[model samples]
Target: MERGKGSPGKAPRVRAILAGGLVLGVGAAITLAAWNDSDFAQGTFTAGSFNLQGSTNGTTFTENPVGSPATLGFTTNPANLSPGDVVTAPFAVRLDGASTYDATVTLSTEASTGSLAGLTYELTQSEDFGCAETVTETLVTAGQTLGSTPASVTFDLAQGAGTDPGAPVNLCFRVTAGAVVQAQTGSTTWEFAAQSQ
Candidate 1:
């Protein structure tokens, strides 16, 4: 028996048809697939400003930076001291106009010089700029020794609305000289540290 030449040609044609059908099937599957898209998100951040200022006369507020402190204008002469003498001074503090958050002000003694023996002090919150005899609130207890800072003497300051400065907190410091107080020059420096809340 002789093999027919037509059989070989038919097999090649069948293979070519099978291969073309496979390619078309693959192309149709890709075209029928679902369409897709994507989205993204982002954010921006910034920091707010904060500042604290103080005033001795309550009219002109400024930042009393370290090394150059504001001198308190005592009602009595601090240079000339006498027994049973009491001197008082007024101070005011507030958050500056640019501040964006409220804060807490803590009072502490930063430095002391000369002889502070036989001297005591008292601190109070006053209703007005003048350290009046009537006390609105007691911040530091009476009879605290000179050059000594009381623990937990703190006050709160609110942030102002818009560009205006916050309301001022008036403070009064009263110092007394005892009978044993000597004729020596002495000075005490107090610090008002503010923390934003």
Candidate 2:
């Protein structure tokens, strides 16, 4: 019958209380968890594009073929010309695509065999029937001789803010055979390329 030792009759109740306390303590130490979830959304992106077009006549433009370059054949090929003869042809360039861009126009001599190399040429941009040297007016300078080493004249193309295919830039080529040009059969090729910036 000591005070520190529980009587035999109360021992079972005390033991039961101690066991319950131990279980409650262990439960408190265990980490509690709840349902967790996450959700996600997907998005897509597309790219823009740039393209150029060329034409001999302002009304008709030819876009570059998907896999090939566009070609602008002279509306009228200059042939059988005598000395002192001057010929002028009209050509045009345009921009076509969803995006707007600064464009560069370049005139490059391809290749030639004959008197065509001896002829001199000048290019002009005309507005309202008045024409100005494209080289002087824009970035390009002077003309090219077909028979000489390959040459290129490049200039920035002017475009309007709202032009869909972009307004056509009217170009005029004045080809002259100097009075002293010798009589010889010759042919030449020239390429005009429009690039986006």
Candidate 3:
């Protein structure tokens, strides 16, 4: 019987591979354990009731101890505000408290007689206080329906690590559309909400 040549170091090679794989697995587990944190998802402030349209916009929206500060505001009437007979309002959103959590605020409009192509939004925040962040819309839809208005907008915030514990932070916004020749019009409600990851 002829003896076949065998790789004498085959067993050692196999052992080395297995050892490397085990080390890598343990290292991965350790890395995961070190970085896994649930606190990052925890919210420091309880969420307050969201008012899509409050006393802000054309007027001032003061903050009450029980209510969250107004981030957006505006007014709308169903009969006169919309291109047709639809109702919509102005809007804003709050970037509030510790900017740790993220949020998206929106404003939408009622059905219109035409398209809202030239409309845009501008957001304003107090330069002295809370950096009152304001954002304006870039466009507003005209052909859309009233009850389905998308005067909506979203925001993502990263509050610096050292913001105040609980201070009144306000983010205001305004809207203007159309040209000097065209009748710039849109109707919808303003909304502000905070969502965290």
Candidate 4:
């Protein structure tokens, strides 16, 4: 018997127990590190387009932008002037086929030169292009002085359905000369401003 020496079989059993403990520790560490997964999301954004167009004959529509305006074809010759004379014109407005938004249109008058004094005008929305004596929807009240901007008069327009141009809004402009209206060359311009809604 040797002093301070354990049995060989007992030493082998102790080493086996230590190896088993290390294996268990490694397994517990792997179990603590759990599996993980993730999810992601995204989005896209864009802006819509809008445009407005006008027509004088209600058939040939075009962009009547500022600086160059469409000429209204008056039923009576506007060149000739007489006291107590009245003339009428038909103008149409609508959203272009490419427009994507509806709009509210406001009517206003620009400054005039010569003979515009003592002349009064009225604006009305009509069913047809013909601006007859009969009126349907009065936009600007009668007796609005020429070259003076009237109070805010607004109307609505819808965007076209499926790429076709929106339905036309027919407008009638009636101008009358006062008894004392001057006899000279004059010019007046009106604006139809549209705001998208």
Candidate 5:
């Protein structure tokens, strides 16, 4: 039945429905315009670093270099076998970067012949340069038995809070032949590794 001028229970006309749709469309467009907006924001980012390096000798503290057989032999070709001989080598470690870092130094050992029998070693530490105050000297009696284990030291080579970079810590390694060492030829290697936390 057509809904038009009051036949019985009549409803709105087509023109009235079209007018309501037009009003709803206009209202929607006005609401959309009110909510439209724009804004501007900005941010920045940067990076940091912690670089560690070391050296075998003082003048060339670049990276640790292994001692050749010719150097560690401490004697001429086919080095003499004996006891009570002490060999000392000086080394230095540094943080070569623009930031401060908390780090640890550990020692590792290996043997190429006879497993370094009948030998004893000592490691001592001191401040070489740029230490704000004296760091207490440390001595560790790393005997011949500590092979391949990372023996951590009591002292830490901390990069001080000050803005100085390229500061070095000096270490003296003393190796002594045991009094009762056997008359045999052997070789051993030791390494120091530094890690940041």
Candidate 6:
């Protein structure tokens, strides 16, 4: 409105409105420091809470006693097994025959992945036969029938030399974690095998 002596549009309109309000307050402080550095990078990584309950420090585990048994390098004497020795597995195990000869046992229980879904625990496997045998081994079938939920299972027992003098075919697995273990994702380990046929 003045136009001239002091200036029309006072000093170019206050230097273009103070350089557009100093570039809008530095673009709102660079958008609030890029949104607080993206919320500290979305709270950052995770995964450090475990309770995969499953253990056996050793009372007796013929094939897998945590360290010895040649660390699964069987040469024989897998508690003293003899009869062509053709036992292989990762499915709970069992076998007994050491009084003499006439034994047959088979165990099976495998299949699981990622984190062993819906895993509950209570496992058992035992054996110690090394003196008598005479046609006594029943439990040739009960292959595989799995189910998982909150998780619960009951296994059967076999290996009977009909009232002889050979008693050491044993396998005792246990896992009473309950509540689906609460938390455990990796190796709740479960390797097994039984022989003598």
TM-score of 4: 0.82
| Selected candidate, larger lDDT, 4 vs 6 | 4
7-64: candidate 6 lDDT, tens digit per residue: 7547888999999999999999998887543333345665422111111222233344
Residue 108 lDDT (model 1): 95
- Assess candidate 5 and give its TM-score to the true structure: 0.61
> Candidates' lDDT values, in order?
0.89, 0.60, 0.41, 0.84, 0.58, 0.34
User: Alpha carbon lDDT of residue 170, candidate 4?
Assistant: 92
Q: Please identify model 3 stretches exceeding 4 Å from their true place.
A: 1-55, 58-90, 106-136, 150-153, 158-161, 164-191
Q: Which ten residues in a row have the lowest lDDT in candidate 2?
A: 128-137
lDDT of 5 at 6: 60
Model 5, stretches more than 4 Å misplaced?
1-34, 37-47, 65-81, 98-100, 110-112, 129-135, 142-150, 160-164, 180-183
Top of the candidates by lDDT: 1
Error of 4 at 98 (Å): 1.2
Model 3 C-alpha lDDT per residue in residues 1-197, reported as the tens digit of each score: 12333565477889999999999999999988886545445558766422222244534433322234433324443223322232233432344344555444444432344444444444444422222333332333343333343444554433333553222233433344333124444433333444554
Stretches of model 4 off by over 4 angstroms after superposition: 1-34, 180-182
Stretches of model 1 off by over 4 angstroms after superposition: 1-8, 25-36, 180-182
Comparison by lDDT, 4 against 5, better one = 4
Error of 4 at 135 (Å): 2.8
The order of the candidates by TM-score, greatest first, is 1, 4, 2, 5, 3, 6
Give the residue spans of candidate 2 off by over 4 A: 7-43, 64-77, 97-100, 113-115, 128-143, 147-152, 157-163, 179-183
RMSD for each model, in Å, please? 2.7, 5.2, 17.8, 3.3, 6.6, 20.5
Sort the candidates on lDDT, descending order.
Answer: 1, 4, 2, 5, 3, 6
- lDDT (Cα, tens digit) per residue for candidate 5, span 1-197: 46543654434566688889999999999988897678999988675555556665544545445554213323223245357776666666777655467667666664455546666666667666322224347556656442333355534566745665556777666566665346666666765556766
Ten-residue stretch with the least lDDT total in model 5:
69-78
What local lDDT score does residue 120 receive in model 5, on the 0 to 100 scale? 68
Best by TM-score: 1
Two-way TM-score contest, 1 vs 5, winner:
1
Candidate 5: give the clashing pairs.
none
